[model samples]
Target: MLRVMTPTAVLLLAALPALAQPAHLQPTRDVSVTYRMNAPAAGGAPAAPQEMRMAFSVSEGKQRIDPPGNMGWMLIDRKANTAVMVMDAQRATMAMPPATVGAMTQGVPPGATFTRKGTATVAGLACTEWDVTAGQGRGTSCITEDGVLLRAVTTPPNGTPMTVMEATQVTYAPVEATRLTVPQGYSPMAMPGGAGTTPAR
Candidate 1:
């Protein structure tokens, strides 16, 4: 049987190398980035690639993420300690508490270790390279000084080909308030038990 990966699991696998962000490097401005993701086919076929655009606007401890396509968007209010997920297609919104969001983004896999390798430049930004190892799997990530991830590659323990996410574009701009607002007439729904556990996907 094929096991469906939860959002939390996906986030952990994708961001293991950058799990511990340096406090001094947190971003202070709104930014937008585009990334290309390549993943090995589950049934051993050729890899498939996808692209996504993400926007991060931080002000007064609030942040919003507008996912690729029309999938939806998410708003995180740190001061209020709440998160809301808006489903664009269905016009539905789900609410999650701070604890759930924390668990999703901050949980580190067991036996995972990270080591700073060196530095590199990506998308015209200087970044520090870090090597990560967990169990029998290995991965590497290049992160910018402001805690932005520029690239990541992971080779699973089962020996499948590596999966990668690379930033293709980066821009600093003020995020419009309208982009972060939940539209009216959207129905409210309960958050899935596992959905809010991760900020990825």
Candidate 2:
């Protein structure tokens, strides 16, 4: 079966702590969030919602995303404006282009507007709800004061809204620096075009 990155991969990567932003897009301190991701099964077959556990680690100006089932991880450097995907099964790394990295690191889509909705709690953490609008996409997000995203529902330009990510657990702890570095021996590989799927989300 074909595989896909976590449903909110782009958003999660773009939302990491940044040096400048009117609103905090990521946690201000070291932290980790485990999310329950729901998306359609690969191959476009109608099936039960696939649930996966993805852990996000953030500290200093770096962020790491550990995808489900230990497939591999992605490391993003906020200061350097770069991102690289580490595939353990293939023992290779795919680096994103600088243009793509720069756009995603902005936290929100260009010209995106946020309207305060209310407040809610998820995974024992309190967060404020915000209605987000950018281009033809619309969605809602629940974010904590320190900039942790607890829940997110996104509607693409002409698609149904889906709950891409929801927090199952949250922990505020220091993350080791080594976890954010690329593996020493992984060889570089050309990034595959459309390497992942969108599924039903």
The Cα local distance difference test for each model comes to: 0.61, 0.63
Name the lDDT value of residue 62 in candidate 2.
74
Highest lDDT scorer: 2
**How much lDDT does candidate 2 score?**
0.63
Error of 2 at 106 (Å): 1.4
Candidate 1: worst 10 consecutive residues by lDDT?
Answer: 1-10
lDDT computed for candidate 1? 0.61
How big is the RMSD of model 2?
6.0
lDDT of 2 by residue, 22-69 (tens): 256677767777777654457544445433333335535777777555
By summed lDDT, which 10 consecutive residues of candidate 2 come out lowest? 192-201
Q: Tell me the lDDT of model 1 at 34.
A: 79
Q: What TM-score does prediction 2 earn?
A: 0.77
Would you estimate the TM-scores of all the predictions?
0.72, 0.77
